[model samples]
Target chain A: MAGKTPAGSARSDAVRNRRLLLDAAAEAFAEGGVEVSIGEIAQRAGVGKGTVFRHFVSKDELLAAIMLGMLDELIDTASGLTTADDPGAALKGFLTAGVQIFVRDRAFCEVIGRPSLQHAEVRAAIDRLCDVAEQLTARARDRGLVRPGITGTDVALLMAGVQQTAAPLLAAEPQAWRRYLDLVFDGITASTGRELPYPPPSHLSLA
Target chain B: MAGKTPAGSARSDAVRNRRLLLDAAAEAFAEGGVEVSIGEIAQRAGVGKGTVFRHFVSKDELLAAIMLGMLDELIDTASGLTTADDPGAALKGFLTAGVQIFVRDRAFCEVIGRPSLQHAEVRAAIDRLCDVAEQLTARARDRGLVRPGITGTDVALLMAGVQQTAAPLLAAEPQAWRRYLDLVFDGITASTGRELPYPPPSHLSLA
Candidate 1:
């Protein structure tokens, strides 16, 4: 029993330290981008450099983990909205939550085209996110709210587009993304009977 | 007469070399981004390293020159479109030309937020571009083609948004941007009578 107590305490400490590193790293990266050094992240975590290495094998691994966390949160948000009473509003709610993540986390946006996306876990999570987006979009389409031929992939791409469009002014006008989002939302939902010029992207693969 | 001929020949050679350097540098930066070395640009231009240094003191200067050229071309395109038969088509034409440049030049997009934008010439050129965009947009607004309060800056930002949204898939789907452009164009022109969520940005200063 005495031996087990020490082992259990050590395991809990590892878990706590891991959480601290992730939170600190996320904040540092969000503020400074992925270029924020692991050393800086350790200092921010109030832990030794060796501790960061123990948890994340490399900077890319740490980034992949962070991206996974973000994707999962988005997935959960989309999943929750799938059965909401208003299909259009549900999709908008999901997009608002997703773009909010990009708005707050500069590193997440910077890392989208980086090699970390090639990580298997990150790829799987993105695929899952697309799945949920499709479900939400389909719900709206069925209600005749979204335009015909609009796909979840199109919605997903447009969400990222909204962030990109508002990125330049995010510092000066943090709520600027809302404007672009509304424009894109109106674009998808206006039911003008005009077809999108291109076929929907069949899949979501940023890697 | 003999001395004048020699000097005239030297001046013409310099002019030709400058043109060559600009073309080579533009192509290199478009393909490899701003990280392409001056030596590589000189090599592509078939000029010596000293020739590149003589024409442009630094890489940023070289990049500024390329950007100015691009901006001037866009300005010309926009200027010519102000009197086009259709106001909406003119704005869309301007956006199409602008986005096509972004699609072709990776460095132009990369340098938008970089220090080079702080260069006085680049800043002036961007302001000029915004002015022309304003002219086209105001024409559309007066004709009730564009939604109320949709400023040229809004149109400008959305053009960039379309590029950013399609950037990730550009390699596999070169024309994907056209689809996003159509979506955004539809957004600005739909006239569904919905007010944009936020006021338009007043000016363009990527610096």
Candidate 2:
């Protein structure tokens, strides 16, 4: 393929190399952490050092790309998740799957949490995630899967909450996060099958 | 008092100044943001610039102290809140109070969210928070206020999520966060005054 000069071949090779670098970079960054070097990513990808820099201008860009890839995966799954029979079930599945992604891919999730990425391009990528959330949330509510009062902003907050919920999954107990997700889902989700465990009038309405 | 014991008086004054500086530092960082200067904080607190340095060696230290103070307030409130009729109700109150603190005192909340402090003291404070949440969750379950299957880690994540939810409160729509909070509470709290709002499930169980 490299020997041939087809019109789309170079772009395809570049795309393929970009994916390789992103996957390798994510693994290296997760294994060695955020401070891991570019050369390490290159070595892991089995690509030339120049190729890594060629695909990404700097370490920050590379890390950002790796993160963008994960975010894309997350958003894509969210988009696909809306097609389920029950919107509530789909939303819960989306939340659980996203949590699993964060637990499985720590460095990628840190793209949003890390202070270093407060820079422009990374901020844009992170900011764009809100739209993804907004759309998914709208779809869920429109389908009657979400609580009636749950607006786009509300779902976004819950999404952030879910990420926070995933932290413990990596720590002392992995299963603990699942329980957390259940609590959260129960809070927002109306009781259909499970007896509503929480009684009414418990919390003083701040309103 | 000052005339009776000069040394004791001076020490007490120093303590008062330190508290003032800490408060000033928290406000400055929250209002203007993380990059605000030490001199500015000293000026805000009506202290000499040197006194700011005397109290905290670095901005990071000041931020950490501010976080410690905020966490202290939260823990105290959470402790007091557990006395509600149902422990589950107490947990909800504490969570609401925590949200109010983070929203009302963003600078301190931002200070706690800082990555720098996550290493030592901050991590312990978070662990202690989890402990409080764990006990609260367990007690709520025993009292049957918590929807069954809820866990401490979920509540912890929910607290962090609520804080993040409150961050854009000032710049966004008025009471947008309040709506978010309402929807979130709907999910976390048990149904009251009305029937569960969703379709009935084929199988249901709650202890």
DockQ in order: 0.47, 0.16
TM-score of each: 0.88, 0.64
lDDT of each residue in B11-86, candidate 1, tens digit only:
7888788889989999999988777999999999999999987777777888888888888999999999999999
**Residue A130 Cα positional deviation in candidate 2, in Å, after optimal superposition:** 6.4
Q: For model 2 chain B, where is the 10-residue window of minimal lDDT?
A: B198-207
DockQ, structure candidate 2? 0.16
Clashing pairs in 1: none
lDDT by residue (A92-160, candidate 2, tens digit) is: 777777666655665644444433444465555445555665566667767665555444444444554
Give per-residue CA lDDT, model 1, range A49-150, as digits (tens): 998878777787887888788888899989999999999999999889988888888787766543334577877777788789999999999989988888
Instruction: Return the interface RMSD of the candidates, in order shown, one decimal each.
Output: 2.2, 10.8
Q: Looking at model 1 chain B, report the run of 10 residues with the lowest lDDT sum.
A: B1-10
Decoy 1 TM-score against native: 0.88
| Model 2: per-residue Cα lDDT at residue B178 | 52
